[model samples]
Target: MPPCASPLLLRRRLSTRPPHREHPKLAALLDVLNPPPPSSTPLPHALSSAFPSPSDAFPLRTLPRLLPRLPSPLLSLRFLLWRLTASTPQPSPHALSSLATSLPDLSSSVPLLLSSSPQPLPLQHYALLLNLSTHAGLFPASLAVLRHMRSFGLVPDAACFHHALRAAGSAADVSAVLEIMSGSGASPTVPVIVTAVHKLASAGNFESARRLIDKMPEFGCVPNAVVYTAMLDGMYNFGNLDGAVRLIEEMEGSGLGANCAPNVVTYTCLVKCLFGKGRVAEALGVLDRMAGRGVMPNRVFVQTLLEGVCMEQRVADTYNVVERVVGDRGMSSEQCYNVLLICLWRVGMTAEAEGLAQRMMKKGVQLSPLAGSSMVRELCVRKRSLDAYHWLGMMEENGVLCDSNVYGTLLLGLCEEGHLHEASALGRKVVEREIHIEASCAERLVELLKQYGDEELASHLLGLKQRPGGLSF
Candidate 1:
């Protein structure tokens, strides 16, 4: 075996051999048993000499150091990332640690190669490794990689710094990183500045975070809608809803000089902040203002509103919020209204949930499975067959409750209430939809219709088996 080959590697090689061929290959392999150490040549020479065939395995440990000499090093960086991010059986912690430890030197050398290549360097390599290290809870190593980028006169993008900031141990470390980024002659992208603000906010240095927003101009990236939105998210997460409001006022009244005024997203984040602090009434006011400006809440924003209302059990405000969002353009997803409706039911506000369900039906909005089931069940129990049919029709139109017995149950309740016309209409629908009910229920409905001399209704009920609309499960 070669001198560098470990016992495990020898076993691996032998395991791939056929029993008969092992003896023959063993003799040939023995001829090249003693291998020399890696050469002392520089990386450019080493790589140029090594890559004629490109598939040869070399010492993985030294590749990062040698990578800078290549015109476009990402070719090899791709291989490195493949090893680091693979899921089924990941690389050893020791190996990953070793690779991350070498990042600074790799980043430092990368800039030297950039002067020759005209393409935008795929610096995502170092950033990706930094992200993985940070995700793996290797914060110090992630920071080391950041410093390495600076040492090499390289600038990592916003996403790279996002991971580092999240992994930061304290507010001070966050400030130190921002300082390094600013001093490194790296032109800060807007996202990078926003990430810095977010990190500082998370670290509870609200004062410093606000200052960073003010200082964004120095980086030649004026705060825009996206940047201000980040600040709003950070401020809220840091538990300073009041500060978030002040920042929004500042952005609106004072202006961010590049249309940084609170748009829908700004109001969206503001709405979250308001509801986060139990200011549900105030959140509604913000929504009105946003809508007045011709920018309505998106699905994500409305969903956030629903979540906060549910979390705090804000029963009184739930209906109004649901009504407004459901009636708006582009905000009324079935998921959003369902959460709002379900929140009402979860907090014991059945009356309010029923009211909202009625409103959703009027608007032709789809109901989620749970919401649809709850409303239909409650309406039927209240002997409100008309309302149940109305809402059920709405839900059916929206293509939900397809595989549920709830429709069958609702039909039975309608029949029992002696609303023969409504019951017959639903019976025809059941036949058309091919929805399943219990055998006895179906037979009872058919027998009742026949006794009442409603031959058409009884025929529809009996024809259920001939249709292809049976419920799926």
Candidate 2:
């Protein structure tokens, strides 16, 4: 008998008799001797020799036998192997390659074992596979792992599903993710579904996004503030303002507050929709309603309203809104003044605009380039040429550098008003300071001189232009 068969012979005897023949005892012995060919060979001793001692070896040997007696020997063996190997210091590339080569059959059997096993895969393995699949962009392989997870009666938590969805979204393969969820009969929570909807909306697949929203209830999903906001933003972005408003109304009817009190996004979205439809009066009414319901308009909302008023040429109303925002503690001083100056300038109210600029100056609020430029243009438009000149002089004197465009505007305005002496002086100052004058501005100045019948001065300006280096005058 083979040396390994000694232990079995001590436990039972065998004889050379066919089991189907008349000798029943001999047949039993023959059956014991020949035990049908093993379904699989035992893993090599070297592989199993990962254990530190012989006492540790008994469990590996007796585990299959003890499985019926001890409930989870396979799990215990897996744990032991992982503890011994995976938790050690990081493996060298050669070690990893050797392990990979040695475990080819084991690797093939893992999926089969995982599929047939009643227990879920260990958390560590799942996490490792997830990270691998993400980096590799291996969607099909990831789906296989997730399928095995389900087969083992495991339910992934929200975070697991969220990460998987994010991976699929990154790969631009949303359908694969959908199929996995469908096959598992698992429904992602509101936030998970909203995240997917947002991705679809960004991809310009509004119809699919809407369909996903419609399917929310079937998955026992309810739209929270985030979900509602995502849907509203999607509809608004796609020019489905009416649909966005209807969703708001539906949210209200479902006992979600239509009042802007708890949900500023819904109210803001509605306000934007109103403005989009050119319903300025209705939009203002909505703002008032938002205010009454204690939904304080954020900077964005207030800015939108101010912009609408500017578009509609409602300067007085826009100014009122700006004042209201300035009165609020949270709004930035710079943004408030900037929008106010723009609205004032848009409606030809240079006087009011100048007042705003003076207020900002007194308060030590820094003006944005846009606000500064707008104020300067208003100064020139009102024929306050000296005011424009003084403002530019003050900016330079105070060491506040203005953009070249600001200087260009001032020079062009001075020339148009037949102030060639001042225009030439300013042009010389620009050239001396190395401030750039666009080619367009030079041409415009020449045109202005011809229009004013100052050909001699125009020729002088033309001569200055021909100089090799920029001239200030």
Candidate 3:
């Protein structure tokens, strides 16, 4: 029999062997642990007789390859337990990773691994187990792993704490939150505590969330703007408007310095909440208040404001809001005008929309493609195809690109209006530009030409159907 060697020597010896070939002693041990069929003595006796020395530990690297050769996972697990609980130095990170990957089922392996480690595994190993458990949707198992780490006096990293809090859902208690701040092997952190508060508040445990924030200063963690904002968002989502407003006022009024002041996101959440509750005037007031505080609006805030104003059909209010945003330079005048123009059309204010479009054009404000499309659609809907075509020509002159839908609408409208010559001219231009018409519009145009007995015009348009790039229909 080969003599017993230190783990380092065993590794060196195994490294010299050919790839995928176990050392002689390791192969014999495998045979002892999993004897051929039913011919074995008891496993403990066989293992002791084959390897008499207590120091006869195997190389960690070979464990991954050894696991598959064993007859049962339980036996493999036993070997892992023996190696983990042995008096040998802790396993290398690489070997631990290899062992973890070799296990077929992470969820099943977690419990066995935890039980086997009387001596706690490395912090990284526990962290890895926590991550695996959370990702497997084993929230209870993840919490168990967290408690196990805490019991072992391991200070889990912030990421591990975060994963635990996230998977805890609404079930995570105030004790766990306080322990992170005041317990041994852990330090109070803003992000982790904020995550806990967010989860608690979102679960409608406002009293506990408030208690946590109130106790923050005792733990050397002053609640900052992000923490307050998270609480406000939770209140907003659950329709606790009065509580949300009160919290906002507290955040703004507190003497926690600039870091705790209400920000753009804070105000935006309030505005959205107000608008959601049909309090349009109050929402607008929040916007004005936000500007007065010298906080600039972000893109999401602008979009929310426009969507809310438009949905309320507050046309005059929308114009005022647009001018306010434009003057504040929160968004470009062109961008604001385009959104306002679409809102006007959507609310059935066609005349007002036309007047706005003309004013925008005179001011050299470029119209968005959507605005142009909206104008063409409104005109055609009113049975004014001739004017739509004229508008399309004007758009082209102003270097505004009209989408293919605009052209298709114009073609069908002209055909329906009995203007075959004008339709033919537009059809040729469409083909020349290689703009593909929608399938329905193309078929309808063809049917109209055929009915008019304009065989030449119909044939010319039909030629587009054969070209792959010419017409979608």
Candidate 4:
């Protein structure tokens, strides 16, 4: 404007303006370029996060308080499953009670989450809950869950009814069973009747069990495959041979053999009872008849017959049975041979036992621990270290460390036999794996190793004396 304002003059004038303490635009740009970092501390997780995280998994008794406390339905159900499926065979009574009592609440929450989700809640979930409650002897809780599922229009599958029936007792409980029997949604399943029959037979009430089956159709339930099987088992259990024979006839006449009706178990139970009454010929005949009906003997059935023969000290018969099982393509050789190996030892047939063991080793059959320890000890005593270690390797490969005392037996025997190399090597493995040795044996081992100039191994053996799991004398 004033001679088009010289470019140099304009730039100098802009630079000479008063300095602003805060350049809002520049500050905004700078903040955007380098934003502040978030706080270092972690955010809070739901209290239910403790599930399967460590505290609530093992020794499941600690799960009671956490059961109902979990917020999400999915979390609650997962917690319940974790507690029930834990390695502990039967959870402590306290845990069982807590789980049983909390099952209703936990189950109530499941539908809410499922309702919004694409997947619907399954009847099996309720049945699983019923099974847990039933096994815990919480009949009221079991029935309560059953009623809840029914209220929610959830029909139990066969397994679920079986679990519920297992908890059935008292007048009210039996009424509940009948109710399920008569209910239009889900009739009594074979497993359910089988459970009832088994419970009756267990309590020596065979008549009631029979009557329950006879009345199945009255309640709109069809007798499934296991129905006659259960009845046969009950009759055999009560020593009613005529009743059992009739049930088998009925099963055969009813075309139950479509799936080999009166399966291996039916024949096995009858054979066992016959053997108990000193009716070996009849038992064998039963086996022949069942085989004629296309129900071949399984490993358990054959092994059980051999067990009876062995108990009676029929050495020749036991061998023959085992030989037959082995030669027959129908039977599993490993199971038969494994049982025979134990049987030979039990009957004090040591020479025969050793021969059988070698044959088994060649065939890769692992002798079970029941006789495995005895075999290993005997082998070592005979200075068959190679054979002993070979069988031990078989046991290891099979993951069937049949005897915990085997290591101690070997170490004592090996050291005494002057097998220093084996003793040293085995001792190192035992220590590394933290297998405890007998206190007396460990002390002796430490001395022996040190005497043989294995001071390091001796120290390791000595160190084991203070550890809790180390072998006790």
Most accurate candidate by TM-score: 4
Most accurate candidate by lDDT: 3
Q: Stretches of candidate 3 above 4 Å error?
A: 1-138, 171-182, 254-258, 334-473
Ranking by lDDT: 3, 1, 4, 2
Per-model tally of clashing residue pairs: 3, 4, 0, 2
Model 3 residue 340 lDDT score? 79
- Mind giving the per-residue lDDT tens digits that candidate 1 earns over 1-473? 11233534644655565423212333222222212345455433343343432223323444444333222333334335433322323435555555545443344323343333444434655666665566555566567767767767777766777777666777787776677766765666776677777777766788887787777788776767777778778878889888888888887775556478777778888878887678877876876777766776776677677667766766666666767776775555566677777666655566778777778777877677877787777767778877888878877777767335666677778777888777878777777776666556667777777777888866666655221123222
In candidate 2, residue 213 scores what lDDT?
72
Per-residue accuracy of model 4 over 201-267 as CA lDDT, tens digit each: 6455667777887777766777665776776676676677777777677677755445436778877
lDDT value, candidate 1, whole model: 0.63
Clashing pairs in 1: 108-152, 434-469, 434-470
- Summing lDDT over every window of 10 consecutive residues in candidate 1, give the lowest-scoring window: 26-35
When summed lDDT is taken over every stretch of 10 residues in candidate 3, the lowest stretch is 464-473
TM-score against native, each model = 0.52, 0.42, 0.51, 0.55
Clashes by residue pair, model 3 = none
Pick the winner on lDDT between candidates 1 and 3: 3
RMSD to true structure for each model, in Å? 15.5, 25.1, 16.6, 19.2
Ranking of predictions according to TM-score: 4, 1, 3, 2
